[model samples]
Target: MNICVFLSAADLDERYTRPARALGELIGRGGHTLVWGGSDTGLMKVVADGAHETGGRLVGISVEFLRGFARTGADELVVATDLAERKALLLARSDAVLVLAGGLGTLDEVTEILELRKHGLHDKPVVLLNTAGFYDGLTQQLRRMEAEGFLPVPLDTLVHVADEPADALAYLERLPTAPQVR
Candidate 1:
């Protein structure tokens, strides 16, 4: 499977690094292909490096604007002219998405993908790697949306949550195959 991971470009404290690396390793060992923001810094780098070290197929996608600042031109990268283009390519190429601890950018990406799924644009699975309960508030907010009938999606379609990397990968592996549309 081609798995797209949404993560921040900002330098993360050790709290976020460890799990990101572990998640990369697990995904690598599972023989899944990795797709992520092509950044050689922060948690993005940690995960990319971990996957590379484990001999996983790593494909990086980066926007032209961030290429110089992020210094992420890995051999596997597919560059785009803008963030939106990069995201569109990633979503088209990935079979699923794994979101790690990140800031606003990560949230935006996840929400966009979720909205895409809601509109029947895609049926890929999205999982939130909730390391140390970092996403507790967001999950609660989702629940609130469900209660208010603001979400037309089934609870299962929102996002899968896992406290650990291994668990997240396992859950993804068990997801029911998307049905044929035609």
Candidate 2:
């Protein structure tokens, strides 16, 4: 499987680093390809590094505008012109999406993917690596949307939460066999 992980390039704290690294390793060992933001800093770098260390095929998609500030080079990176283009390319090339702990940027990426899935733009699974209950509020908001009828998507369609990297990868592997999509 090809997994596209969404995470912030700013938060490189231990709280976010451990899981991102572990998850990347697990994804690589599990024989999955990794697609991620091309930046070589912060949590994004952690993930890419882990995957690359484990010998996983690493593919990066970065926005052209952020190329310099991001300090990510295209000699080894697959660069896109903008965020929208980058996201579309990632979504199109991946089999799943894993969201790690991040700030507003991460939230935006997750929400955008969710909305896209809702409209049948993609059928891939989206998994949230909820390390230390980081996404509790977001999960609650999603439930609220379902309750208020503002969200037409089934809970199963929106997100899958995992407490650890292993569990997250397991959930992803089992997604296609689950009865929900069928």
Candidate 3:
């Protein structure tokens, strides 16, 4: 599968980078492609490096201004005109979306992804890899929204929250055949 990963572009500590690397390596070892923001720094770089070292395919979606920072050795790289275009291309080129720890840009990407899925724009499975409880608050808020009927559909129908990379991979690998309930 072409697994798209939305993650931070900023340098972070090992707490964040370790799982990101592990997830990337897993994606590669499973014969999946790593589609990402294309930045060659921070967790993006770490994950891509892990994938590349394990013989995984890399597909990077980068914007025009950030082209200089794009990964140089990706199997494929596409430069979008803007962030919107980059996001669209990232979604278009992948079969599934995996979210690792990220900052503002990552947050923006995930919200848009979920919103689109909520509206049936796509049915691609979205997994939030909650490494080290990084997304604890966000998941809590999402569940609260579902509990209060703020969401149009059940939260489980929109995305799956996985605490570990292995869990996330297992949930994703079982999809379309066995749907996740929460």
Candidate 4:
């Protein structure tokens, strides 16, 4: 599977890095690909390193402005003209999306993906890796959206909330778009 991970570019606590590393390792060991923003710093680098070390393929989608910081030696690196194009390319190139602990940018990417899924634009599985309950508040807000009729589709159907890296990968692997396990 080509798993697109949207995550932080900032240096975070070990709480976040640990799960990111585990997820990347899982992706690599499973013979999957890591498709993500091309940044080579912080959690992005940590996960990419994990993937690379474990023999997983790397496909990076970076913006023109951020090209300087993009990961080197990626299996494939594509620089988009802008953020919108980058996001579109990232989604188009992946089988599933994993939202890790990140800041506003991570939220933005996940929101756009969810909106697209809600409108039936795509059926790719979306997993929110709730590391250290980082996303508990957001999940609650999402649930409220469902209850308030703000979301046309059930929140559960829209996104899977995972407490651990393994759980995240397991959920994605179970989805229809993922490769059939032998």
lDDT of 1 by residue, 27-129 (tens): 7777777899888888988998788778678888888878864434454788899878988998987888999999998999999998898888988999999
Candidate 2: residue 2 lDDT (0-100): 80
lDDT of 2 by residue, 38-138 (tens): 77788888887788778677778888877764434322466798788888988887888999988887888899999998988888889998888999998
Model 3 lDDT tens row, 116-137: 9999998899999999898999
lDDT, candidate 3, at 141? 98
Give the alpha-carbon lDDT of every model. 0.85, 0.82, 0.91, 0.93
How many residue pairs clash in all the candidates, one count each?
A: 0, 0, 0, 0
What is the alpha-carbon lDDT for the whole of candidate 3? 0.91
Off by over 4 Å in 3: 177-182
TM-score of 4: 0.97
Q: Per-prediction TM-score, please?
A: 0.93, 0.90, 0.95, 0.97
Rank the models by TM-score, top first. Answer: 4, 3, 1, 2
Weakest 10 consecutive residues, lDDT, candidate 3?
A: 173-182
Q: Over all chains combined, what TM-score does candidate 3 have?
A: 0.95
Give model 2's TM-score versus the native structure: 0.90
Instruction: Judging by TM-score against the true structure, name the best candidate.
Output: 4
